[model samples]
Target: MASSEESFLARRIDAEAFPLAVVDVLALAAVLTIGVINHNGVEYLSTNTVGWLLTLVPFLVGWAVAGPLVGAYSAGAAESAKAAVPLAVRAWIPGSIIGFALRASPLFSGGFQWTFGVVVLLTGGVSLAVFRWLFFKLRG
Candidate 1:
């Protein structure tokens, strides 16, 4: 049994969390796009939007599933870089792994390679951590 105050607090947190989640999505898209361009070249993005989407969607789905589970988009998570960076990295590990699994699926054209997976794990974590830090720093 939740009180009216508790319900209102939950609603308020929900309002705040939605926008944060949207920004998280945007940040992830940017990071993933940069990775694509780095590996596949800018022409790949311009010439093959479907390929780009196929490459990108898995990771987005990964984060969409992982972020909330790991509290990456919570109000508390957004409160400071200290909180955000660790949570972002924690979320990113499982998220990127899920992306790799999705990439290996027949629905997407790409297959997972260990070297590429390692690169994604390392760079994606760093990118997300830096992004989270910057997000908090700039917001503050």
Candidate 2:
């Protein structure tokens, strides 16, 4: 039990994972803005930080969980560190699956479809690519 706790704590403090999580959260925020639009044609998009954060909860949860589970944030993987883009792409698979599942809950009004899954996959991969690249570069 102590070993498990320690492992959990170590993962929680991981520097690379921390930034990746932030990137995931921010990416979903952007996705919500770009993927959904007011058909009414507002001159500008309004900011609702509270509402936006609420909507992002599922994505954030998925991303944070996926990194540790998939070894995306594992220490000392030199080859993966050298190829962050592929790592990002691979990590996004399970990450987005969890995101899709959570976001599909009835709590969210946005209906999930095949295309939404694809959008989530693409956006998440792109998002992780940029952030993880930065992480690898900085870590080096």
Candidate 3:
């Protein structure tokens, strides 16, 4: 059993973890914005709130899966960028592929290709880097 001091420390650690969760949500929002732009171009901003809504699920799933492995919730405790990058990539790759496929489908008619795919990949990668850097700066 843990003592009161230990419990307090544990709560403190948990409190520190909240920043990482915020980072993950921000990263997801960034990626979703990129996806919307790629799919509909600048015109997306002018019309259709539904497109934005459609992006929420994948963003949540991607963030939830990748955030823990990449230490997005643990601040400076990630093993290294080298360790975290691959995990972020792994989490986003499948979602990107699916996004591309859906974009290509007749149901939507927005052409998907390497360009948007690359954008999504870069967005995910850059998000990890930025979050990691912020974590170090803020906590380390």
State which candidate has the highest TM-score: 1
Estimate every model's Cα lDDT from 0 to 1: 0.79, 0.62, 0.59
TM-score for predicted model 3 compared with the true structure: 0.54
**Model 2 residue 104 distance off true place after TM-score fit, in angstroms:** 1.9
lDDT of 3 by residue, 17-126 (tens): 56555765677677677767776786776687676755555446655654554344443335445544454556566655655566666645456668757876678667
Candidate 3 residues lying further than 4 Å off, grouped into runs, are 1-16, 34-47, 69-112
RMSD of each: 3.8, 3.9, 6.9
Better of 2 and 3 by TM-score: 2
List clashing residue pairs in candidate 2: none
How high is each candidate's TM-score? 0.83, 0.67, 0.54
Which runs of model 2 end up more than 4 angstroms from their true locations?
Answer: 1-13, 37-51, 77-83, 134-140
Worst 10 residues of 3 by lDDT: 69-78
User: What C-alpha lDDT does candidate 2 achieve relative to the native structure?
Assistant: 0.62
Clashing pairs in 3: none
Give the Cα error of residue 122 in candidate 1, in Å: 1.1
